[model samples]
Target: MRVPVSSKIGVSNPYRSWKSATDPSPGNYSMGVDPNGGQQIVIWGKEGRRWRSGQWNLQFFIGIPYMSNNVSSFHGFKISLPDETGTMYITYKPPTQDLFRFVISWEGKERQLKWDDDKKKWLPLQSEPDPDNKCELYNYCGNYATCDRSNSRRICNCLEGFKPKFKDQWDQENWSAGCERKIQLQCQSTNRTSRENGKPDGFKKLKCTKLPDLATLLPSEENTEACGKRCLENCQCKAYAFVTGIRCMVWTGDLIDMQHFQQFQQAGNFLFFYRLHHSELDGGRKISNLVIVIICVVVASFLVASLWLLWRYKKKVKVSSMPCCKDKDVAIFDVSKSKRKEFSADLSGPSDILIDENQDNGPELPIFNFGVVAAATKNFYEGNKLGQGGFGAVYKGELPGGKEIAVKRLSGNSGQGLEEFKTEIILIARLQHRNLVRLLGCSIQGEEKLLIYEYMPNKSLDNLLFDATKKAELGWRSRLDIIEGIARGLLYLHRDSRLRIIHRDLKASNILLDAEMNPKISDFGMARMFQGNQNEANTVRVVGTYGYMSPEYAMEGLFSVKSDVYSFGVLLLEIVSGQRNTTFRSSDHTSLLSYAWRLWSEDKAMDLVDPSIRDTCSPNEVLKCIHIGMLCVQDSAVHRPTMAAVVLLLESETPTLPMPTKPTYTFLRSAIEEEYIGDAQEIVSSNDLTVTLQY
Candidate 1:
């Protein structure tokens, strides 16, 4: 195989497959990075992680014993995380090349073997050191302890300030009983009186450290001082390490796998564990004035350069302005006059798309010259389009001034007429919040009515929550943030805004995602404005995404703030489960709601959690979210708490959730159509399946 020398395939597998007719079966053993990022390579069997090579030092795999034999040779490899985006490869150029290759035995043994031409059989060059016992498995020694390899039998000894967690487990060779603190650190308020433990049992250092589990990749700017301070602040933090390239990797909770190494070549860079409160970091005094000095020097240089630039620019302008003045003035006058003529006002908020000359609003919302908008959006090109919805197509447009804004071009034939268009403009123009999307004014020239808003970079929540690849990126923390953000936005709509607004259409698609994945509630064309203590209202035109619509609103046109709550509940479940309420299907259940309810009833709600979340996500926390979601989608409007309550519940650890009754109507579309009449007056009639109110 003439593969290029430059090209490499990263293979973490410890074993190689058999190539000849003599060996008929595939290799059983494989080696790869520990999923926990413990700097350990696990030798895995068909069923489970069989044994680990303790953890790596800078030079060698720590758990495996070094060979001092003259015939034996070993080479170890280590690379910084940044260099390892591709697969790992190894090319061994030994002094003697006698048809040697790496192979994994059928029964899961890893070895390097040579072909014996005379014997016509494969001969073993090296086999894994410990042949027969489970005790050879790495980390078999409990934490704060080291396995004494000097003796025929491995002996375990505790490091300073450590003792076994379970004495019985340790005596029985169940070494994973690990180690517990000799004196517990008092983190809780009730443990304040336990001062006899000596100022929260400080850390005892191991000279040559194999860093602990789950090392979080810290930002590059973080230094030793900040890392130390961070580690000290968290009571759970067991140890902290500050390396030159790796920077900070803090370990919290248990320190599982610790081992000793002799004759360290690259044992790892310096690691610090909290032994006791050492003298506070003195590096702050050294770093303070350096940044200020740099800023001052840069500012002085900029100011001096700016004066010279201004003088040159003035001379250039003086030469250019004379000839162009008359031509520019005439052009300006004509353009100004045309602009003045184009400036017409209408009561229906500023129209960027169409100009209503009769109405009295400034220039009828500054309708974009179609040519300018066309050029900006590359002739309404598909590439420039942000997304499309029931109202119209939203395009990503760059103005003449190079300012980017999202232009929502309302569909002319959309079910929502000019009334809804005007309402959105008026409502958005009057409202301003960091959480809410900012309305950057509108355009109305002739038929085109374009409303402009700040462009959110991440598109919409639907793109993320429902996408398999994207959903993995939005882990539990991000999901929780999105949930909290939506809650805040809803709170603004319902209570904080000048008018109490009910976002009649509150689906995942309508929720825009900011660059940071923060959720911004959008699509207000269908949002109803409530005035002066109006708690509930009914609309004949029941408009919203079908799956998200509350039973009261979908079958009957009675939609209130409570209806919005129901939609939010659906959104909440979708966010947590990474499954769409509408598209989800099951053999036994009709919809996501029924499936979730069944899971909740069966006490298997955790099963609904996405499998992609391999990180530390609390099961109780997920169940609590499910409980809150169920509460929000309750059949009775009165039973559901307001957005305010939802926000509080999401934030509080122990929220007193009300017992959610079964929803009044199942999301069986066929069943709903047969039972509920599709009439404006019929919708207005309150029944067990509906809630009715007159607008």
Candidate 2:
């Protein structure tokens, strides 16, 4: 019977080396520090059979190609060697020390063992020598067949375009003879073009493989495309593949040891052969990949130019499509009577009335190619996706000049479609401010509509405040800068810009964070254009997100610039407290605003500040922001301060703010369903015009 106990060393289970056979003395094979470096593990053996396990490679054992499962999986497996006077000792940092052990059993079995929590006993994890024997050994199939570990029945097979060199030997389970080519062809015959008149012999695709070694790595100095080109140029370079992490690898020598992963572990490379002419390779359809590449590049360029033109066309269409609202004072131009001249010197004048109506004397906005955007975004791979929203997914991209860009691909299914796209472009093109996201260009390729904007490396403010690990980065200084920047942006929209516009949607997600953590308001898909004299409008149909909308706007579809003020107040509170307005729920409080109000009334307003930001924040500054947040979110639209006043209070050290009235944070949509108020709108025109709200 075996007795078990635990010792303290690297979090793994520790034990002393067992005694030797002849004299019952302790054995030399033990886990200890290396003489050259104290941080390595060296396995000592009798006489001179010492095997160097090598130093810790930060992630795994250096000498072993088979990475430690624990280390590779990053389950907190670490090895440490402590320096002492007598000798250095080794230890591990696993979840539990009792779970691991290195044992030199009495029967000559030297293995790293682990106490399986599920099995409840010491189990052999891995041995010094791999358990596979005979065919399982490396290069077992005589350089032709592979020994698959996952397969139920062990078998051997030759690579494509080849057959067993010695069939009798292989059938007898002695596969040393390897494989031979099925057909005998000279170098000239291999290139079908040489034999005929420039043609490909053929190609075969192999799949689910560990791949062959040495002979596969293409000679160093070759670019991926060039390497592939070189392989095709030569008859001997049979097959090739451009690996994901690794570049191109080609085979010149005889192919061997090819295996297929069961549908489960499917992982293999392709292997092509050179034995036909150009037309013969791919049913005569396979043009030289080089030619295909050239064609693709030309096509891409044409497409980019076409997309740019299409974007221009769509912009023109959007301008012409603006409907004449039933307003007595506004003069509507008759497109049918107008003579249209070409915007560009080369193109002829517009032939259609709709096209003629869009003609304007204003400067043309820049347009980008859909192909360029696609290349920048790596074809919009899921890994490059930044975030999703009502509009569409935002993808991070880098332009040719190392300029990063955020491409917003509008959704086909969005409720607010072409109107929003055109509105953002028209509004952003005419404005320039530090607090606003700059629109670089736009692309309209078929049904795909993409808007390119200055990339924000830090993403939205919501990402930081919502993440437990990242929230700390939003310190008092950064948070305050964001608040001020947002205020400046609103001030520009409300009073400083050429157009008196209202950013009807002003939540944390809409505020993009740049590399310096500076805030830039983005996603103007739902923004509204207010005439210089217009103050408020009423409608039956209403649209906007909850928690940040004013009461009248949320309930009766009555929206004014005050709606934005209320939303700004919600944003300010979220910034100060580092919490979301929508997801905020408390058993004691009805909403985030209510919670803050309760805290303020109870003389415990400091409790509302995020614990992450509390350390560096000043009590007075935070209290001031809280006070301003309450003032802006006050129930009455008349009571809320203009963005101009809000900016002043935020920047100044002294301001005697009026006490806030009870806020109408929650709007009674009806007696049945109550929607928390927030600023939201749906654009319906290209002139920064929002749609009439209709529930």
Candidate 3:
């Protein structure tokens, strides 16, 4: 006979606390799934939610990323969607021989227990909301602060450019007051328009961060670059972050619940905040005046001393010289003095020399002798040649140890001279990343300058990406991976590395693929380092590849991280469509950018995908990439996403993407032809048909 309960049976809340084992009355604490249907298990205090298991993502809960891997073997735990009964449930099948149980203690700690037969007692296997990880505590560090587990002394600290709001409270270990910006944002002031006229506020990049809370989702039509511009334009915007799954997330007021992770942990998110230029931040007016004063004084003293010395030297020279014309002697003396002055200036500023070979100083990098490089490359034989660029020809070489290497030998007539060669050695040698090409060593003898790198068996991305025969080998997955890899490398250069670098010539050819088909960014001859919050710089000599150059960079000689983003965008489009941006000419459009804009506007974006990979590629993923690529190639540098955002967009399965505005169709056939002619004459003659346009 079945015993029937008098009352209707309902699901018991684990969060509900019991006064005692004998007392059936419930206490204040209660635990249950979130009623908002967010797929998170939450424990509630008398007031509100005390703690929550992060949002579930079908496979595992995101907050505890390692949960699935750790618990799968012991208990096959799974969350089931609502069925016809309209009831969502979580279930787990225990191992046949082992016994286990779940429990919520009086203190609101949730744990899984396993029976140990030998001990004849229950053992706690795992616990939710681990107290040791302070991040698990809600708003543990308060607003505008990030909790870092790696920091043993203090887990909480304000974000860059921020300071404690209540100094006394902070010192007393009370972080509830949070922090505030040390300097008020220029855009927030009444004289914002006038202040912005001189130098607009820019973003300070923060890497490896957990995004803050209460982020407003930007419009679907906005890219990360546009998102930044929008935030800068608005006085209310405090900080912004862009991730793959979550598009553009801008925080107004105070940023909350942020965290920083160690290098080994997964910290892919990047945060940017509006701030005055580095000069302005540190009392620019006073500093500038003082610097100018000191420089003028030094210059005046040097000039006076030089003139006196020159007069004495001339008198001595006249005494020692044979009878000659006074004017002729004076001219000869002036020419010799000028030559000496130039040589002295060169010695004073040794930007090109990482190490002085003549001084017997140990080089920052290994120096391969000219003879060794020549022998390895078979005496620069044509058969051993790998590729050629504006710098020079790269040849495949094998060392005595059977180690393969790629040697880049600069041509005598190459536009990239000793300056660029030294730049490559200095920059590439210091930079270490999986996505970046490894610089083995260098060789400099007489007029010969060579940069040795780890040999890439697959060669450059263009070798396969553009070639119809080899394009098939790069399936949709491989192509996507390649794009992501390139993005990560750029991100490293722009944000992660010790030095902030802008790869002025980021293109398909510069992207070399390793044996595993992994893309490694090569060729740093054109790269520039930004020191101490210096984001953008200008040069009279504009040097970069033609099609990849951003509008501001190509036209006005202004280059920054965004310039690289524009080139990456162009490369992304090229990879997707299997066409060169400069050479692509169709009946409907003059260049690939124009053609893509047309297709995107007409809602025929899929048509832009290479037909070869259409069958294998995910339509959504391809469309997203196309949209992201268009965003990157936009006319305004301010409207392009950073490399960090690009990496997230490519890697994350973020459903929604910002709509791409009509990219500037600036590719003129005559202009392209003119640039091509100029490049061909000025740069190295290459069979690859690529040109580095220098204005």
Q: Sort every candidate by TM-score, greatest first.
A: 3, 1, 2
Candidate 1 clash figure, as a count: 33
**What's the TM-score of each model vs. the native?**
0.48, 0.47, 0.50
Q: Give the candidates in order of lDDT, highest first.
A: 3, 2, 1
- Work out how many backbone clashes candidate 3 has: 3
Between candidates 1 and 2, which one is better according to TM-score? 1
Root-mean-square deviation (CA) per prediction? 21.4, 22.0, 23.5
| Model 2: lDDT to the true structure | 0.63
- Candidate 3: deviation at residue 314, Å? 42
Residue-pair clashes per candidate? 33, 31, 3
In TM-score terms, which candidate is top?
A: 3
- Write the residue-wise lDDT of candidate 3 on 1-695 in tens digits: 11111112232354476533334467556776642312455566667655555444444443453463454553455665556656657666775768987665554555778999999999977544354476766677788888887888777898767889988557545576788877666665567575667555667777555555445666463567877877777767766655544456677756666666564214223344534444334444465788999999999999999888887775333221213324332211212344434433432322423222221122255556566677778899999999987778999997654668999999998888876776777678778887999897776678888888999999999999889898899888789889888999999999998767888888889999877788999988788877646778887677777677787876677999999999999899999998887667666655788888888888999899998988657677888999899889888888888888888888676646677666643545325554455422322223223333444
Q: Residue 294 CA error for candidate 3 (Å)? A: 60
lDDT for each residue of candidate 1 in 239-291, tens digit (9 for 90 to 100) = 77676545676776566555554434243446456543321222212445889
C-alpha lDDT score of every prediction, in listed order? 0.62, 0.63, 0.69
In model 3, pairs of residues that clash are 15-30, 15-31, 16-30
